[model samples]
Target chain A: MHISEGVLSGPVLVSGMILAAAGTTVGLKRLDYDKVPRAGILSAAFFVASLIHVPVGPSSVHLILNGIVGLLLGWGAFPALLVALILQALFFQFGGLTTLGVNTVIMAAPAIICYSLFGRAVHGATRKAFAAAFACGFLAVFFSALLAALSLIGTEEKFFKVSVLLLTAHLPVMIIEGIVTAFCVAFLKKVQPGMFARPGMTDPVRGEKGGGK
Target chain B: MTIMTRRMNRPKFRVARMRRVGPVGFVLLLSASLVLISGVPAALAHRVNVFAWVQGKRVHVQAAFSGGKKVRNGTVRVYDSKGALVTEGTTNVKGEFSFGLRHKEPLRVVVLAGAGHRGEWTLSREELSEEPETPASHSPGGASTDTSPVPGKSSPEAVLSREELRLAVEKALDRKLKPFYTLLADSLNRRPSVPEILGGIGYIIGLVGLATYLRYRKEGKEARPE
Candidate 1:
């Protein structure tokens, strides 16, 4: 979810931007320039993926494949995401220039988690891998939704109010994203199997049978 | 009336006396006259409003104005947390403007909204920091640290005269070093546009196609070994 300029205090926006710079710097330190073109391509896919919209409650929801980007690029996803988001901010004003950092951190954290935890496990066994992929995608979206909810938590009393609104808004989209992630992982298994072989692709691979269904 | 007289001299291919026209022609004539009369007054009322978001020596200003009138000119100014003026200049027509700090230290900025507009906000570098920092100083640098309010003139925090604010913004804008501006300009160059959508789509298609070709090619290699 995008945060408009002026929605957050200048201090918060600035702090977030600073953190984003640090995160991006850390992300860049590990980047392999050979894969940069691929990263750009995937980032573009991530950008366009969100354009495929589905109506949820009163608002429309779309896929945020940041988890998939994380799975593919690891730390590189942070910078890639920053680029895509900066573009989105400039073109669509989807988020304000001031709040870009907050939005990036919100969207990218779930990606980092999903890639770190579930990415490799998804490559281990077809059914198990797809299931884990689905869960990871779903969780990333849910976590982002939660962060967005938490951002507004102080302004509105009771977590339930924001949680209910956010979860309700994201429910359909999360399901859609989960299914897409599952299919995409399955597709990758058949095609670019070496993608799974990438170093640090995921945190230590999870046991096959124990993976989420 | 003065604004109208200036426009009349430009050149007109068509002219008609509205009062002499028949009822049928009157409505058409009246609409035509209104359309011609409405143009210049709207142009005269136009003025640009700029909102500058400053981070340290780096700044980005966005311009918007009433009735879709584009920003013609504006600038930004940086003051050390103190009231002393640091630097100023005119902005590009895009309404985008920038400035830099040599020290990499935080500073304050007083943005003149635009030409002929009063100044608002005494923005500080702390306002643009990504993380909180301990504020170092609070003076107009070399200028008298006079926090004393002038009776008729408002504090810089409250507002400044339009021309003074314009100059302040100009200083803030012009003070940016070329290198930082170049980096920002380069990033902006890579910025995606509607045309870039083709590139995005092509990338996805290539990914899928490359994956397919690689898979088929791998299968062929395995069969040859067999």
Candidate 2:
């Protein structure tokens, strides 16, 4: 979810921009030539995913497939998500340019965190991989919501007490994200297993470069 | 579950899972998402917008999201140019609220759709008096407060034909142009069109190609180490 412009305080917005700039720089440096296409594709996916409203729920929140982005792209999630967020701000007005940095961090930070937590586990057994995928999807949105609520804390609106209220609004989105991520992981495991390599672009399945999980 | 049998195994199982929600499922989901994202997209979270203006005797406000969804039950706050709260109310089911045209200076209307989403609109003092002002005096209170036709009819000496004609025309115009306000808000915050989305995708693709080419050059045009 995007925190619209003018909602955050001045210092919060500035800090968010600094963090976003730093993250993007690191992401670009780590982005290898071969991974460029993958990053672009995932960027497009992140752009389109936020528009896909979960049809199963009455609450109406869209998918933020940041878990898949991080699963595939490591630190590169920052740059990928930043690009998508810019387009969304410009075209969809989902978030404005002033709030782009905060929104980018809101989406990408959870991705990196989820990737760190469960990156390797996806290569395990089918059931375990799916479980990890569900966690990845669910928690990515969870962290996004928490971060959003935290950002709102800068406005001095009883941050702790109100954060739970915000979390309940995101409950439906979290479940749907979990399901979609599990499904996508299952699908990708069959069609393109090579996409889920570890850092430095090494393959874990064949153990050719990554030297086994 | 399709995911359980989705692992590499008997070709029969792979086929069956594929027949269900495997890669085929991805394709189905992608198509459905494309359809939903095409036009008339729904569910815009945290994108609130407010549009308010002086309409007849009241200042009307409308709040909506980028996806054409109303910001239902949102709190509406009115403030003068100095940012002091003048009045407050809650929007109805249609995301609309109204307040008396009491202020002479510019007024700011802020709508809080909750969850850190906020939007504001401003109305000028001149627009509030464009309807009909009490003749023979320039007091903004006299003009903004006593806009009722009942009082205008009761006060025989204070009535003017031009003022009556203006009020009549404004009331008729307000009714006729009511739908246009929604249109104005829609156009102001319309969602990305298909071409705009395609263009964004194109930019990503182009950036990908550029990054690949630049990195390829840096690596001395090797075979990508595949």
Local error of candidate 2 at A188, Å? 1.4
lDDT (Cα, tens digit) per residue for candidate 2, span B68-187: 577778889998889899999999888889888764778888888776677888887777766445434544345455556555454533445545665678789999888887678667
Instruction: Estimate the overall C-alpha local distance difference test score of candidate 2.
Output: 0.76
Expressed as tens digits, the lDDT of each residue in B133-220 for candidate 1 is 2222322431233334455544655433433554466557656644565455333322234566565556545654665676678889
Cα lDDT for residue A36, model 2? 75
Question: Interface RMSD for every prediction, one decimal?
Answer: 22.0, 4.4
DockQ agreement of candidate 1 with the native complex: 0.03
Q: For candidate 2, lDDT tens digit of each residue in A1-213?
A: 687777888988999999999999988887766677778888988887777664322224677889888988888899999999998888777778988889889999999999888888887898999999999989999999888888888773787765776677778778877877887787777655656756544433344325322
Query: What TM-score, over all chains together, does every model reach?
Result: 0.48, 0.81
Please give the lDDT score for candidate 1. Answer: 0.56
In candidate 2, stretches whose alpha carbon ends up further than 4 angstroms from where it belongs are A55-60, A199-213, B1-41, B124-126, B135-162, B182-189, B220-226
Least accurate 10 contiguous residues by lDDT in model 2 chain A:
A204-213
Worst 10 residues of 2 chain B by lDDT: B132-141
